[model samples]
Target: MEDFVYFFSFQDPNVAMVVAGITLLSISAAMVGTFTFLDKKALLGDAISHAVLPGVCLAFMFAGSKNPYWIVLGAFITGAISTYAIEWISNSTKLKEDTVIAAVLSVFFGIGILLLTQLQQTGDAALSGLDHFLFGNAISIVYEDLMVYGILALLVIICILVFYKEFKLIIFNPSFAESVGLPVKRLKLLFNTLLVMAVVTGIQAIGVVLMAALLITPPAAARFWSNRLHVILMLAVLFAVLSGIAGAFISFAVPHMPTGPWVVMAISFIAFASFFFAGKKGILSKWYNQRNYQQKIHRDHILKSLFQALEKNSKTLEKDEIMEYFPGKEKLTRTYISKLEQENKIELEGEKLKLTPSGLVEAKRVVRLHRLWELYLAQYLNLAPDHVHDMAEKMEHLLTPELEAKLDASLDYPTQDPHHSKIPRDNDL
Candidate 1:
């Protein structure tokens, strides 16, 4: 806790700058990443990250030092080349996408390693930090490197802001976008270029190997929390910024530690939390909803059975009679009856269970929906009346009033189903 407070205290301008720089970079990367993740082009980021290594080595070789501008230029060139090559190979040949990605990643990384080894043998002190780009050393980022990253991040943000609608259309339906006369092909190339640039800019601080996580995981995690594009983008940026700050602080507290892996770890933690806890789409939410839905269905079924027994025997059923109807589910039946009593849907009189007037109306509606659906299926879908009952039995709880009305109109307001059972009127008791 003290370490965290000390890290963010901003007493040291260097620490403050590093934290701010990492936050900006992470936000930009995660924003771009959300789109790539939605479009299912995450592997492309990995490919570009590895492909930029040779360019980094080449830039170092030419400049004989760690010049940010030269390195970025070199990285962008190789990154673009790798992206284009993958597209070219995928389009021109029968190779699968995974195969193409593997080929490009291995070849480019191998070449980069060779160039790095050559540079290492030359014993140049200025080139000392160049190798860190491979695995990353975020603690070593100087103010100049941060400035370069800041500019690149700004450019990425600008591109995303200006092209937001175009990107959204392309991602959801490229064919539809093209039909509307949008430049689908050029826009795809542009998106790929931006992805490459995002990867290239992170090479120094996040490293090639782990940079892919920054580009993919936050956005992927954010998706579990929102379905809307704008919401997903916002959440992705938030998660990324938090991860970046945490990772930067950890590195600051522990001298010489690489920032990339810790950032990836922090992002993974956020992702895990989102997966299990986020509302609507999260695992826990889905589980709760499923359980509630099952309980509702069970209650509806019990009410339905009580109605059926009353219809046959007149007005009420003994507790033992109801239990006998659902022998295997007797425990469930008893529990649901208790719940219904609590809800005031049913009441007990001596040894018998009776539906209140309100309960009778709801039970009647369920029965009507079931019989109406069964009739509709028999007449339209040509299913046997007996076969339709089982399906209608399950669908009764799901039918909306609008759907029931539609079914009623389609069936021409049939008074009786194929089974000769009277379909209860809306005002029926």
Candidate 2:
């Protein structure tokens, strides 16, 4: 508890810097990731992240020390090169983009490993934490490192804000953006630069190996909660912040625990939770809605059958006879009959069932929608009356009263369907 308080209170200057740097990095990564995710450039982000390791090694080789400025500059340069290489190779060759990205990722990362191994052989004291870049060490963030990474992250956030509309246009509708005189190619270059910067910002705190998670996971998870771009961006930022702080806290509390994997784990938990529980799009909600809808369709079928029997001058039907309509679903049909009885939509007398007044109205509406659609298909779509029943059966439970009215008006309020049977309406009651 004392550790938790001390960590969060930011009482130590170093702790404060780590927290601030991580938060800013999270925000930038999430914002860029939102567009990157929407544009489906996730694989490219992964490739650039792995490709930056060589640049980190080259920067260390040139600077003779672990200077954050040299490291970030080198990392950004190589990351950009990797991005262009993937684009160029894919466009110029018969190879697909994914194949090019894979090759670039493997070659760059392999070179980085070779360079890093050589640097380690020199036995330099400064090389002590150099390998931390592969995983990450949030605890090692000093003031100098914070300054460089924070500034890069802030720049990414600012550019995204300033060019929000252009980015959106280019991502969602590049042809339209080009038609409007937006520099689609230059904007893409600029965005790619920002993507590299975002990755670079996290390379120290989240590590190159896990940096793509910082870039991609938050926005991917946020999408399950919202469809609005701004809302999704906000949610992504919130999720990233939570995961980043949790990772930082865990690293502070546990000895020798790398922050990167913990952060990835935290974000993964949030994502899985969103997948199973988000309101409209989640698995549980979708399943519940589908079950209810299927039940409603079944209930409508039962009512329609009863009404049709009444039309034939039979006021009631034996329960077994109605169950015959659902050959393999006798149990489910019986359940619906009981539910209708409980709702006062139908009544049972001995072995026979008949619709109540409320049930009759509901049944008439369903039947009317079915016949009206059949007539609409016959008169306008040129479908034969015999060919329209199947389509109408599926659409009957989906039509709204407003749509029914529209169909009636368009069909000139026909009294009979193409089958020459009465198209029952409220007036007919």
Candidate 3:
């Protein structure tokens, strides 16, 4: 607790700059990342990230120092080249896009590693921090670094907002956008430029290797929480900002924890947590809904059983006699009957279990649907009468009242099913 307080206390100006810079960088990455994700361009993003390593090394060697401007410029040039190379290779050949991306990523990254190794051997004092672009050192973001990355980040955000409609249309349905006379090709170019910019801005804070995570994880996480594009974008940005801050704090509070992996871990934790607990689409909600549906099926089956017995004898049975129909599940049947009684759907008068008026109506409806479907299948599809019962048993629980009416009309309100079983009517129960 105390460490957290001190971490954000802004008592040191450098910590304050890192936080603000990372926040801006995260927003840019998240916005671009959201678009890239929707367009299924994650591999392209990965390629750009790894490809920037050679640019970073070249910038340091050429500038003879760790100048932020030169490094960012060099990284942008190389990243853009890698992005174009993937597109060119894929377009000019029969090779798949994923394969082209993989090839380009390996080639560029391998060359960058070679250059970085050579530079390290030269023993230049200024090259000591060049490897910071590999795993990231968020604490190293100075005011000058913030000014450069922050402005680039802001430019990305503004471009996205200005061309929101064009970007969205291009990503979701480029052919449609083209048919509608929109400048589909231009929009894609602008989007790709912004994507490269997003990668470059993060090379200092998120690093080259893990930049892809910084770009995609937030959007992937937010997808579980929202269905709308704008809402998802906002949620993604929020998640990214939170993760960036959390990662910085851990690295700042502890001695040697790298910020990039911790940031990925934090956002990944948020994504998994959302996957398990989101209201409509999560694991817990799915389990809860399935359990409710099972209980409903149990209730419907009990009601139908009681109605069938009454049809035969015109009288209710004792609780033990009702158990005769359930076989081996007598204990479960008692629990179900007791619950039905509590819900006022059934009553225990003396020793006899009887359906209430509400129960009778529902039971008649269930039985009617079952009999009607069985008749339709056997009469229309020519299935044997005995073979239809097993299927009707399942379909009876699925037919909505509207569908039941349609079935009745189609069968012309048949009095009996193919097996000569009485199809219970509205007034009979």
**Candidate 2 residues 336-383, lDDT tens each?**
999999999999999999999999999999989989989999999999
Error of 2 at 423 (Å): 1.0
Best by lDDT: 2
* Candidate 3 structure, TM-score to reference: 0.88
* Tens digits of lDDT, candidate 3, 140-180: 88989999999999999999999999998988888899999
TM for every model, in the order presented, reads 0.94, 0.97, 0.88
Error of 1 at 304 (Å): 0.5
Predicted candidate 3: what Cα RMSD to the true structure?
3.1
Ranking of all candidate structures by their TM-score, best first: 2, 1, 3
**Which should have the higher TM-score, number 1 or number 2?**
2
Q: Please give the clash total of every predicted structure, in order.
A: 0, 0, 0
**lDDT (C-alpha, whole model) for all candidates:** 0.87, 0.94, 0.89
RMSD of each: 2.0, 1.2, 3.1
- Candidate 3's C-alpha runs over 4 A off are 317-334, 349-352, 368-426
Q: Could you tell me which 10 consecutive residues in candidate 3 have the lowest summed lDDT?
A: 314-323
